[model samples]
Target: MDGQREREGRAPRRWRHGPPRWNRWGDEEPRPRWPWPSTVLVTAFVLFGSNLAAHAQETERAGLDPFARALLFMTGAALLWRQRYPVPVVFGTALTTLVYLGAGYPYGPVFVAVAVACFSAVVAGHRGAAWAATGTLWAGHALVAHWLYRWLPPPGGPAASWGQELVIATWAVAIVALSELARARRERWARERAERADAARRRADEERLRIARELHDVLAHSVSVINVQAGVGLALLDTDPEQARAALSTIKDQSKEALGEVRQVLDTLRTPGDAPRAPAPGLDRLPELVEQAASAGLTVEVEGKPPHLSPGTGLAAFRIVQEALTNVVRHSGSRHARVRLGRDGDTPRLRVDDDGPATGAEAGGGGNGLAGMRERAAALGGTIEAGPRPDGGFRVLAALPLDAKPATHVKEDDR
Candidate 1:
């Protein structure tokens, strides 16, 4: 169970780490660290098949010379472990080619070994090693062919002719170039994938932070009010039954509203198909919002006629007032507060001010409240101005566009 927990914890951290690293030299880069058994078996089959074909060709061309045939078979068989030790395989095959060329055998097995080494080097992300291996193999073959021609030329003439040398050089360059291209393509694809994954992770983190802040502000303020009202109701249960009943009713209403808000938030957090289909609170609920604040012992006052605002603007206004009132009830040691909502030209404006203590300490707590309110407003392409007022109070002013489209009307409509 402990091991399972460890794995579970690491899974998210690994996901949060973004895509896999593409750095070829890094310890974490993906590579076949060990000699894969399947690769070894496949390489062996290829070697055996190629050697058999070469043997048949050599027999048809010049009859089977026992010594030459045995050397060719052994050289081909040795390539089974080429991927495990590419450099060693290259040297071994080169040596075998020199001996075979001297003994009048074909150079086909050596070319096969060069191809295998190139593939291994590319897959292992060792371009320099592949280049060096190809160069050495070509030089060794040329030198061996020159000597073989001096001793025992081909049926027609010397094997070190310009045509033969050109063919060998071209084949070597092609193999090396192909391997490098494959490696580069793999690296490019890995980089693009990593970038996309990082962007997705960042987006997820930002969304999660937004949800957390909303939950904290909503639950903290709502629950705190319910607790306060419940206490007040209990205290006045016997002496002032009527007021106590009203306090209890307020407690019930606040609790229900808090539950509904939490449920809506949770639904938003749910996976898309599973989320509840509920309409979000908008400016239409502003009156209920005022009543809720009034029940929480705040003197919320409205000043202007409600204006027709865009959905986004309306939601922003509601959240702004919600967060502002929440802060006033929780932090401000004030009994009276004013909330003014109006239209100014093509913009919808909201101003929330509280008659709180004038001390600097009290003023600083409003900073967080103002920030939350500002964020709510700005998310809808709106602007907010919040600070301690000159007249020993706190003020929050937000202006949201009535329409997402550019403003077309400039005439002021004062409330």
Candidate 2:
């Protein structure tokens, strides 16, 4: 029984995920009900019911206790497992058909049971077994017709036998063709389902990456601010208590702000699948951002006239500036940083420069922060260049469109 189920597609009788263990059923995913298997069982039941009724009537009329009725019941019951052991069930049913016909019982569509099994076998990808069963049944039919010939009136000549063969051949061909068509449809459905799963997985991975980048940007900038303030507070604790107190206060405010921003990013997971959320940071917050950096002891000069910008471009610009300034504080050890934001034709350009070492962490030369800024710019179909300037300073220059393409020519050193 296990072997039979194995050949068919009974999903291990447990742990059904996709198709059966062997994939013989082409059912990687299990349906609530096995439709094809149910079909074979239903066909078997109908054949059994009809043949049993005819066999009973024949027994009453001819006074012969034929065993074909019980055999038909057994054959039909065996067909319930046709999906599990299609080839075997088909052979068994066909052989039983011959026995039932040889027993001098009335012929009442008993071969229909075998036909259903043959259909199951062919559909299950056992073409060899199905054709063998078909040939055997055809020969059995010829034998039965010959056996009954002497017991009944002759219909006609060789034309009658030829007509019988033609009918049998046509029915057999139809069954095979129908099974093949159904198999084709099943394969197509499986392919479509697989493609959809792959697409869904890819989308999930992209979302995870987006969220990861957001977390890194928010936490990295905020934590760096708190770190600088803490260091200053520690340095001024004894000599300048008032200055140290102010630094501690800055730390508290920046920590709270960082917490809020982190919470916002995390909350995105709870948002409805297609709900409208808050817009990203834009140039409107640029003044506040510059003020905060000023409070942190970075003498920053901001000069830019941003055009009307979309949420995406605004967010990209804001993060680039934030990360650049944070890098200014951490890597350059420079007291002064310059920020320039303006429009040159269609492209909105931003440059952050600070007097810092040409090599090392201060210049944003090698770190996740710089790489993330580049990704942010790239996502907006823009380019950014970050490197050491000729005057012993670190500079980050990024130019992205506010919304539409820049009407004027622009030079971009993306690498």
> What TM-score does candidate 1 reach?
0.73
Question: CA shift at 319, candidate 1, in angstroms?
Answer: 1.8
Expressed as tens digits, the lDDT of each residue in 20-95 for candidate 1 is: 5546434265433445564455446545654675577664223336766566655565565665566666666656
Worst 10 residues of 2 by lDDT: 151-160
Error of 1 at 291 (Å): 0.8
- lDDT by residue for model 2 (250-361), tens: 8899889888877777777886484435667777888877877887788988886755778778877888898888888777757799889787787889999999763234
Give the TM-score of each candidate: 0.73, 0.73
lDDT per model, in order? 0.67, 0.72
- Candidate 2 wrong stretches, greater than 4 Å: 1-67, 94-108, 122-160, 274-278, 342-347, 358-367, 389-392, 399-415
